[model samples]
Target: MRTAVGIDLGGTELRAALVAEDGRLLARRSTRTDAAGGPEAVLAQMTGLVADLDLAGARPVAVGVGAPGPLDAEAGVVTGPPTLAGWHGFPLRERLAAALGLSVAIDNDGHAAALGEWRFGAAIGRRHFVYVTVSTGIGGGVVCDGRLLRGRGGLAGHVGHMIVTDDDVVCSCGNRGCWEAVASGTAFGRQARRAAAADPAGRIAALAGTAPADARHVGTAAREGDPAALALVAEEARRLGAGIVGLIHLYSPEVVVIGGGLSALFDLFAPVIADAVATRAMPAFRDVAVVPAALGPDAGLVGAAALVLAPN
Candidate 1:
């Protein structure tokens, strides 16, 4: 079976894996992204990682990278993604290709995750689906007619920036009322902290532990039956659901897969999300299944592999 090298580059860490054509991970390695050192340092770390992924005798056909975007995928350049400072216009694909002596393909992490699910996880055999990751921020990827829907500039599927409210919260993209600004993990964290500060005697504050309050603390408090935390989580779910409803109205996908760090709390929020979609989506779109991603944390890595093994 043919194999390929898959690299998932995030704001804080980088993961590389050798994956077979059938989607099995063969070997893997990970390291912190030296993002503070700038793009050159990050590139060096990526190259070194690829060199270290003992592929044995199975030579990789190509390298596939799933990186945070606002990138020019066609040109293989990073275009000022807020997560990666000093990466504006950096020729990541060309640099990786030169260092690894292999052709490289790159796309936004959200697209890669969607592709990965389409190829080997929840959306398999489905011709139309959407994948949304809600973490520090929200991002999305869409597959229609069995093909990834990268727009003319490979900038499609950025569902996070879609306006969902008239609130004053500003997004990292500098937009107010973006879906991400109101519904992402960052938003949850901010809200949780505010709630904690407002009610110093509440369980929400104690649930936060020594760390700053975040979505996870909200989940913990909710799980422990804190009504205030439950209400906050419910609100987050509703906001997220509103975005998914918009996506459903636009794409009419067969399935919507949710992933990312915040998805760990899916159980607490899934019902609210499902209810919102069922009640708010158009009749024809109501049947769309909203599901959790099956590949878990490996979705990006596998999706990166799919970029080379099953280019779309």
Candidate 2:
């Protein structure tokens, strides 16, 4: 079977994989992004990762990358994504093409993940849906009428930056009241840490066990029925659901697939998120399926490959 090279470049790690068209991961390699080293350093590391993957004698036809955005997908340029500092105006697609001697494609990581789920995971066969990744930051992609919505600048899927509240929380994107500033894993961890500080004897602190509290600890404590953690989770779900409600109003999607780090605990959050949607969404949109993303952590990688395998 023919294969493609997919790279998932994040603020913390750079991962590349050899993947079959059928969504099978043939081989993979990864390393820390060391983002502070600048674009050239990270580019070299990404190239090395692809070279390290076991290709099994099958030459990849193309390379696709899912990177943090504020990018120009059509132009294949990285245009000052908040997470990838120093990558402003970098011609990522052009550079990768030169480095790999293959055609290159690139898109926002969120958009890539949505494409992955659409083709091979949860949203398969669905013509309309939204995919949200609630990780260190919130990011999303919208599939409308069988097409991923890539606006003029390929910036249509930036649901995270949607201003969902009037609070003073400043997002990494330099905006106030962004959904990401309040509902992302980073927000959850910050809330957990604050709760832990106030109540050093609380379940969240205990779960942290001398380490810093994060979203995982909150999930664990909530699962254990700790009141503070439970409250935190409830607030998180409500804020997340509010964002989804906005999406429903805008897209009226058939489903909303939740993914990313916090999604590991979707079993616990789904119910609350669904309830929030049920109460807040219009009656016409209440029946939309709110489900966990099936692709897990590989969604972005597979979606990146899908960009090469299936352009749309």
Tens digits of per-residue lDDT for model 1, 5-104: 9999999889999999999999999999998999889888989898899888899999999999888788888888999888888999998899889999
* lDDT measured at residue 72 in model 1 versus the true structure, 0 to 100: 78
**Steric overlap count per candidate:** 0, 0
Q: What is the TM-score of each candidate against the true structure?
A: 0.98, 0.98
Q: Pick the candidate with the highest lDDT.
A: 2
Q: What's the true lDDT of residue 19 in model 1?
A: 94
| Candidate 1 runs further than 4 Å off | none
Worst 10 residues of 1 by lDDT: 207-216
lDDT per residue as tens, model 2, 1-312: 878999999999889999899888999998889899999999899888988889989899899899998789999999888888899999999998999889999999999999999988999989999999999999989999989999988989899999998999999889999999999999988999999999999999998989999988998898889999999988888888899999999998999999999998788778888997888999999999899899899999999999898757
Per-model lDDT: 0.91, 0.91
Give me the overall lDDT of model 2: 0.91
Give the Å shift of residue 251 in candidate 1. 0.7
Error in Å for residue 99 of model 1: 0.7
